[model samples]
Target: MYHAESFAAMGWETYIVGYKGAKLIPSLLQVPHVRELYLPQPPAFIANLPRLLFLLWAPYKILFQALTVLSTLLGELPYAPEFILVQNPPSIPTLALVQLCARLTGSKLVIDWHNLGYSILALRLGASNPVVGLAKMFEKTFGRKAYAHLFVTHAMKGVLVRDWKLLGIKAVLHDRPPSHFHACEPTEIHDLFSRLDLRPAGEDFLPPSSPPLSTPFTRLRDLPPSSLSPAFAATLPDRREDRPALVVSSTSWTADEDFAVLLNAMAFYEKRARAVNSPPKENPQKGDKHDRLPKMLVIVTGKGPLREKFTQDIDECQKLWQWVRCVPMWLEAADYPLLLGSADLGVSLHLSSSKLDLPMKIVDMFGCGLPVCALGFDCLSELVGEGNGRVFKDAGGLAAECETVLKGFPHAPELEKLKQGLVLQKSPTAGEKWNTWAEEWDRVVKPIVTHRPGVE
Candidate 1:
């Protein structure tokens, strides 16, 4: 969606071809002037069948899907497109077929490599499997055929050059959130919370009773409600003026993320909070407030296979800690930005599939001015640093970091410094960055599209 919008902003006509799935939010289809071609999708049961069974049927499925994509391009496009950009991962037969179609149409093929197909297969089927070896050869052969390549990180580019010997006009194109996500107003946060039922009516759970932070951007409340997804919504605490410190984490509920580590850290934080807030029985004081200890609400978003188990674990932990609230949710696309804006801090447990790709979620969090506590990765320092957040090696380290942030909340000077650091972090607007990228893309493909003698 970001790429499509960026190209559209540059006055280029754009079209998106993708599968129709439950996770595809309808609002995305509303991007102005951009046509969409949705391929038929198999039923959920078939798509989610046992790994072996799904693999057995994959070849035929891929052929049918590829043919459908090719036919759609031929029939719907008034003329052959000058360029075709395709995402990779399930690259095996898809990229190969797309390359064939691009050749037939005289379009320049640009492969955006997100992850190697063989690496994904190896992760699931074991690195030593014979099929994994075959997949590596298949991906390499087609991957190098692209007219140009776009990588999400420099680390990925280095790996491809070193490991696969892929050479072409390649550059890093980091993911970024839309400008609207950068600075949101308090009323907009409140209104979104109300519409999403993120907080029950009459409840007062807003952050500490201080003036809302100010930013240079326009307030979201002035925008129409039609911009938000009407289908699904999640609740948050209602009272912004006195709400607990907000810690938010979004996950895909897969093995790549060790949710157990986060759960353990939360448990440790609860234990420490209990110890600190325990009453001094010897000097019984009168008229003491019942809830003097600072509280925290940890909202974990995203749905996946491990969601149920992790939610149960969180529920069990919450039973013992009154001051800690853990809410697990699945959010629609529109609600995501508002949710991030409402958070005081972000936590990410993503163990990258490749050290090269950075977490898009963290980028969005930074756009919202939310500091992060991310699990360390080889290239994480490029995004996270002293002011914005910390990197942790284990549950113990993560727990300690969480404690430090929580203990310093509600006017701690150290927490204020972290906020200042978050504000200082800057990058070019998505439009400027994408426009520069589009220029590079044009340079790489113009000759190929115009000077090629004939279609292969």
Candidate 2:
């Protein structure tokens, strides 16, 4: 969607071709100007088949779907499109068909490499599988045929250059969020919460209270109301003057992320909180405000296969620590930005399938000026650093970091520096960036398209 919008902004007549069951299909259908070509979605039974069977069936399904998509394109497009950008990793039959169509229409081909096809298959089927080898062969052949290539990270580009020897006008285009997602004002956050029904509609609003240096920060009790739906706000606890620090993580429930690390971190944080709130019996720091522990509200968004198991784990953790409340639920696209804006801190456990592609979730989190605790990966230091966020090696290290942040209370110096770093980090807005990228891409591919044998 972002790429399509960017192309449209660059004065290109944009059309989208995809499947019926894609995540943003419904939203895309509503846009009047963007022509859409959709293939028939697989039936539930076929879609739900076991992994091996599904993989076996996928090639036939993709081939049939590709024919439908190509037919639709031929019928709907008045002229051959100047450029056809195809996303990779369903790369076998789809790319072959796309290459065929591009040949017929004299359109320039561009492959946006998200990941190699074989890498994804290798996760389920071993790397040594003959099928994996075949997929890699297809990727290399078709990838080398494209007029230009776009990669998400420099590491990805390096892999292709060294391993596949794919050479062309390639560019590294990092994903960015829309301008509206950047550093929201306090009032904007309040309004968004009210609109999303995360806060009560007509109640008196209290701005988050400042943290005190001397006393225990018990005043940080009021937190974002918890409910799967906004209508359940009435059933939530009464709003307080101060809100607890909000920590959030969004995941796809896949093996790529280690949710156990996050869970263990929370457990460690809870233990540290208990020790802080209740001092040792020998000294008994009764009146000391510095010993007070701050409250936390952790919201992990997105539903996946591990949700049920993780939910049970979260329940067990909550039972041990009353000060901590964690909720896991699927969020609509409209609610996602609001939830991120409301959060004070973000946590990411995403381990990249390839060393090259950075976690886009962390980028979105930074766009909202929410600092994060992310797991270490190749090229991660390019995005995360000392002031903006910390990268951890294990659950214990992550947990220790979380405890350190919470213990600092309402005004941790490190937290303040992170917020400042986010503010200082500057880049073009998503639209501007995309428009610039499209212009550059056009310059690179136009000669190839125009120089075709049939073109005047």
Candidate 3:
């Protein structure tokens, strides 16, 4: 949706082709320069091949993809787009068709890679699988043939660089920002949160009489520090504001985003908080009466089978924290600005296990100006930057880091400086990465699309 919207805004006609029935695609129906061609999914009976059989020869999968592309091309010729931006992974065979059509018709092929599907699939299925190896070879060959490539993270580009060093490909590193920012407003945001019935975690953490920290904590690096303008700071009541702590939020309620680390971290945070409130080494109280224990509330906003499973885990950890709120996945475009403005931090946690690539929520977090706290996988840490984000090598470390981060909420002077620095350094806003990417495509692709062979 970010790419399509960006290109459309740049005055280029962009058509997106994908499986027809998935309602979860980033909604792009309203963008003026964009159109969609949804293809039907393969019949379940045919697609239900055993893993061993599917892995036996995946080239046929590519051949089937080509058939899908051929059908789509025959149906879409009337549009005659100047360029074709093909998102790889979903339609491997369609990519070849798009490339062939573009070469013949003078249209440029821009291969957008969110994840190296073959590499991920291979990782999941084991490298010994014939299909996985074939797919990797096929992907490399196709990448070499592409006119241009767009990778969501430097890590992804690194993978291609290591694998295809001789190709001299100009693979661009692009960012995905939210589509709603083009026209989001405060009232719309407030209304959206109200509709969602969401509250700030800190408010939920403390009693009404306790004064809340004036500013939310956030990390800053590679761009201007978030403190200079207070532009993206969550608008909680302003008290004596110190630099806000880096706040990261994620619901371990989905298959894609890992919940175990989050659950463990919740447990760790409870332990650390308890330790902080415990009696000093010199004096030990036999029975201290405290009204409430310090806790961090994590608000979740999605649903799935994974969510159902993780809800039990979250419930298990409630003995330590005051509450764990898992709301329905009801947030809309209008709600983001307010949440971004009010959120001190943002979080996206995913398993390092292959198949789950970059989540769009990371882009949404950057758009809202919240520094991300995400598991370090493929391209996440590279995109989030070392200073502005935190990444764990594995699930074991997540709990300790989460506890350390929460206990040390935005209290340091350096934290404020970091925010100020990022604000100054960021050129096009982080949210503008996709928008800029669309313009770059026009510059490189338009002339190629329209150039005459005989003309200089």
Candidate 4:
């Protein structure tokens, strides 16, 4: 979407072809200069067949992808495109198919390396698996032959260049959030929360004496932060100035990212919150009671295949936990960024499939001036640096990090300090690495996308 949007803004007509029902940024389709060609998904009976039947599935899967992509790129496009940009990982037959189609259509192929398809397969099947070995060889053959290559991290670029001996243009294209993501105003937050119809975690957490109330969002839209309620209080809980800690995390719920890590962290956090807030059985004394983790509402957003299972896990966790509420939801494109901006803190459990690609969610969180605690991996430090975020290796570490930053919640100086650091990073002059998507696109990508034969 970023590539298409940027190209469209640069006055170039862009064509984006993908599976018809796959999730796309809704705003992408609205761009006047961009045309979208959606391909049909394979028949449900074929696609939904048990995964163990690889014999029946693999050939159909490859043929479907190959035929659809080839037909769309070659037969349906308005004109013969100068270049075709493709995302890697599910590279498989797509790479081979796209490469063949690109040749037949007299177009250049640009490969965007998000991660290695072989590495992702290694998570499910061991590295020693023969199929994984074949995937690596296939990617090497096609990926290395790209007209240009875009990498998300220096580490990935270095590794691929050295090992695969890749051909053509290569550049580290760091992922930065688009302009839609920024710290939202109080009114925007309130409007989103009101529409969410946020219920309390349970009766034990807060006792609501009155029936649920409603607000006309239009009337509240123009109000200032002071006139508006704090975001965490927008739920059906106490309407006092005090608010629950609002933490947001978004995921597609794929197998690569272990959702269980977050579930465990939330459980750990719940225990700590309860321990800190509960009255002691012995001599009753309050010593710096305010300096403890606040009750939290952890909103996990985005949809995926694992959503039903994850929601079931959340339900079970809620049964035993009182201080934190974990709920799964899907947000509209515009509201997604607003929620991130309105959040007190963000959590990312994106254990990268290849350990060489940084989580895009962390980038969005940083863009919204929301500091994050993200799962650590090889190339993560490139995006998640010291002040704005912290890295955790496990669920316990994540819980501890969350407790550190959010300790005195609602008035957490630690969280505010991180947020300030993220705010500074929005400036192009903040540091070389802080360049916005537009600036970086102009510097690194525009030249390649716009280059002409025999033209400087």
Q: Could you tally the backbone clashes for each prediction?
A: 10, 2, 22, 0
Please give the distance, in angstroms, between residue 432's alpha carbon in candidate 4 and its true position after superposition.
3.4
From the highest lDDT down, the ranking of the candidates is 4, 1, 2, 3
Residue-level lDDT tens digits of model 3 in 143-245 = 6665566665556666666766524234444554543432224344334333443243435443333212212222212334554465664443322223223
Q: Residues 1-456, candidate 1, lDDT per residue (tens digit)?
A: 666655555566788778764443344455565777787764455455677887788677777777777777887787888778888877867777777878899987878887677876776678888888888888888888677777777788888878878756666666656666654566566555545533311123333222223111112223334664666332222333335677889987876788988988877777877776777778656323433335777889888878999978877766666566778877887778888987777999987766677787888888788888999989887678898898998888887887776564555454567777766555334333323334444443333434542211
Q: Please give each candidate's TM-score.
A: 0.80, 0.79, 0.69, 0.89
Ten consecutive residues with minimal summed lDDT in candidate 4? 212-221
Could you give candidate 2's per-residue lDDT for residues 245-268 as a string of tens digits?
678899978767888898887787
Regions more than 4 Å wrong, model 2: 21-32, 45-48, 195-241, 283-293, 427-456
Q: What are the Cα lDDT values of the candidates? A: 0.69, 0.68, 0.53, 0.79
Q: On a 0 to 100 scale, what is the lDDT of residue 353 in model 4?
A: 76
- Better candidate number, 1 or 3, judged by lDDT: 1
Model 1 scores a C-alpha lDDT of 0.69
Q: How far is 289's C-alpha from truth in model 4 (Å)?
A: 4.3
Error of 1 at 220 (Å): 18
